[model samples]
Target: MAEIVLANVSKSYGAVPVIEDVSLAIGSGEFVVFLGPSGSGKSTLLRMIAGLETIDSGTLTIGGQRCEQLPPGQRGVAMVFQNYAIYPHMTVRENMAFGLRNINLPQAEIASRVADAARILEIGALLDRRPAELSGGQRQRVAIGRAIVKEPRAFLFDEPLSNLDAALRVRTRVELAELHQRLRSTMIYVTHDQTEAMTLADRIVILNERRIEQIGTPLEVYMRPVSRFVASFVGSPAMNFLEVDVSRRGAERLVTLPSGAALPVPIDLPNDGRYELGVRPENLRVVPSGGDLVGEAVIIERLGDRTLIHVRLADGRSLTAQDSGRSNVAPGDRVALGIDRAEMHLFDASGRAWHPAQAQAVRATETA
Candidate 1:
């Protein structure tokens, strides 16, 4: 099995810590992505698993073998970096065969491995071409082919597609997914792009401030974020936030928005004075009036299929709501927004999320 396990792994450069007390268990053949903003230690964590970086404290086991004390070459893992890392002078075939030659593999065996990798990466036609003659995507495929020839227990990719243009990035991302399906090998990828994480990963590990903030499938984190950081970071256009007051009206829990509209929340919270209301842009629609909140449209983005209306409330808070593509709303127009109550999330003072369904289930269990 190619499963990897890390126990309380902590790493630091002198006094400043990078990854601290991080533990994870990656199942065999799993495609896991480390996702976060820059300097969030996602790449560092991947490097640790690849044996490129040392951990100050913890144990790392890869494919059932302890590897923290081993050197990178000894670890049964291959890494592909952000840059293609292919040599300018060497042809694609030579670049892929270099490592095997270093280990003194027989010439015939090396040629067979290179040919198989080229077939797998669909770069056989470019086998004799140097890096300079290849496109950015081609060079990246060569880099992956080099790792594939190693046939390592696991593959680690560090933003390998970041160098490509938008279109190439999308194409290469699909190729990577197909590669994983064919190989069924454990793969760990690192990237700051949430789209890549959402599309490529079987599970996403979101790192924040040198530690993991959340880990789950893309939809899990998108639909039921555990905290404000996740709810704000995972979604495009982002989740809107507004400070709201809470009160218990008989048996119903109500939240008062800045627009003076009172809405009922399913989850029964504590004697709440204040909480943050989080609603995604897609969860809101342009309404005429008497909605959850009313605001003035400050900006309108016509994005083909859907339009985004940025509204500014009287209290100076801004929110973005989605409208029809042919929306007649214009900038500075008075626009009201209706929210999806089931998709609403509440964040307490500590930024912890209280999902209605989860909280309702817990409440039932508590009284059971």
Candidate 2:
């Protein structure tokens, strides 16, 4: 296993830049995921690491060796593509052994490596079957086994489970997590799916238009997003953002909603002229009358275990809140809402988080 480092690395096609001055360190034996929407440079960045795309500037080092100039085969990295890329006519064993054979390894050694990989992937029984005969998930496993047999210093996965059905995707996700635990190799995965990034990564790198937005553990990014973009992108149902004017009520700062209602400030926010109040659905509670915020329930989504309420406030801004699945509230019901002061987040005009004291003061005012 090896640590991968990128220092001011960038990629561009002519004048159109795909990745811009991206620098990051992936530690040895770490599972790091690159997460973003399509055209967000996530896959482009992954390909740059695999040497499938040329870097316009900067350096890439793997295991302490500069690899920007090295060919992919010599980088000591193996990549599993989204398409599986298995040979239709080749058996699983043959597909796994093909790379080793091309390098003129001894027959016995190639066979041993292939066998070991198949056993680890739990596909030994299917070794003699051709790609066409195997299921989609099985074929994908063969593709991974092919990479495993190479024994590279690191593994790169480009949306490896995107092609599978929902049930199969979940199963393969678990299998990949198990594989990482057993191999303990440095892995870099790229995906547009937040669920995949949250579940598999030791750290998630949030990428936006050619730049890194935030890098942190799953819970860190979810609970304490540094930017409004991350706050809205990282969670299911996303966080609710309401534009508010920051005004002082006595000595404390209060956020005035568009509807002319004021909520207590929990955090000490800069008396900045403008700000946004961010509250996650899970942090907002349906309360009896006299709560800090009031909204009319516009839509209700009832999942088996939980319900999501899309509420339209008096000012026309909408917010979603999570509730117990047994909640009996129907559309058109006016409900009072309480936001957990500790869970409230405040963003400045530039969308960055304000100081904790500012946040706490806002919460305190709202609760008061």
Candidate 3:
């Protein structure tokens, strides 16, 4: 296992730059994930680390060695692609052992490594089967087995589970987590799936428009996003946003929503600035009457365990709130929504977040 570091790395396609100056340090034996939407340069950045793509500028270091100039074969890394690139003509055993043939290793050593990898992956019984005779999940295991036989310093994955069925994907995801614990190898995974990143990563690097947005643990990014983009992207049912005006009353901050509700939040704000209020669906509550946020339930999604109510405010703005699974409210019903002022998020016009302090200040006096 080895630590990987990218120092001000950059890449481009002719005149169109894909990755800007980005620096990150992945500790040894860590399971890091690169997560983003399509065209977010996540895959391109992973390729640069694997030496599959050229780094237009900056340096990449692995195991304390500068390796940006090294060829892929010379860099100690193994890559697993989206499609399980196993040779259809070769048996599972042969496919896993093919890479060792040119390395001048003894035949017995190669067989031992192949046997060990198959055993660890629970594919020992299918070693003699060709790729055509195996299932998709099995084929992916063989691909991973081939990488394991190389015993590289680090492993890189590019959406390795995208091709599996949903059920199989979940199972494989658990197996991968177990495998990481067993091997404790350094791994960098790239995916557009937030679920995969949340479940598999020690740290998540959120990328947007070829730049890193926020790098944090899943909970950190979810709970205290540094920017408006992250707050909107990390959660399942995205957070709700509403334009609001900010004012300072003594030492407290007051926010006036378009719905004419004045909410005293636990965050410091400039006396005058364009700000918006953000609240997660789970934090917003639907009340029978006299809620701070008055709205009509335009859409109700019953998810069995919980219900999501899309409420259209009087001012024509909309927000969603998660309610109990047993909620009997239906669409077209008039309801009141209440929010925890302490849980609110304030974002400036520039999409920057203003976090509340740990110690709560005195509440602002009532405003007309």
Q: Best TM-score goes to which candidate?
A: 1
Question: What is the Cα-based TM-score of model 1?
Answer: 0.98
lDDT of 3 at 64: 96
lDDT of 3 by residue, 1-368 (tens): 99999999999999999999999999999999999989999999999999999999999999999999999988899999999988889999999999999787899999999999999999999999999999889999999999999999999999999999999999999999999999999999999888999999999999999999999998888888889999998888899998888887777667887878777777865546668788999999987778778788999999999999999988788899988999998899888888887788988888988777422332333221
> Which residue pairs collide, candidate 3?
none
Error of 1 at 204 (Å): 0.6
Candidate 1 yields a Cα-based lDDT of 0.92
List lDDT for all candidates, in order: 0.92, 0.90, 0.91
What's the best-to-worst order under TM-score? 1, 3, 2
User: Per-residue alpha-carbon lDDT of model 2 for 1-368, expressed as tens digits?
Assistant: 99999999999999899999999999999999999888999999999999999988999999999999998999999999999999998988899999999999999999999989988999999999999899999999999999999999999999999999999999999999999999999999999899999999999999988999999999988888889989989999899888878888788777786667676675675464678888889888788677767889999999979889999988788889878889988999998887777787888878797645555567878899
Candidates in order, TM-scores: namely 0.98, 0.94, 0.95
Off by over 4 Å in 1: none
Higher-TM-score candidate of 2 and 3: 3
Give the alpha carbon lDDT tens digit for every residue of 1-368 in model 1. Answer: 39999999999998899898999999999999999999899999999998889988999999899999999999999999999888999999999999999999999999999999999999999999999999999999999999999989999999999899999999999999999999999999999898999999999999999888999999998998999999999989999999999998899999898878899988767667899999999999998776888888998899999999999999888899999999999898888789898888999999889888887788889999
Supply the global lDDT for candidate 3. 0.91
Q: Candidate 1 at 349: error in angstroms? A: 0.8
RMSD of 3: 3.8
Model 1's number of clashes is 0
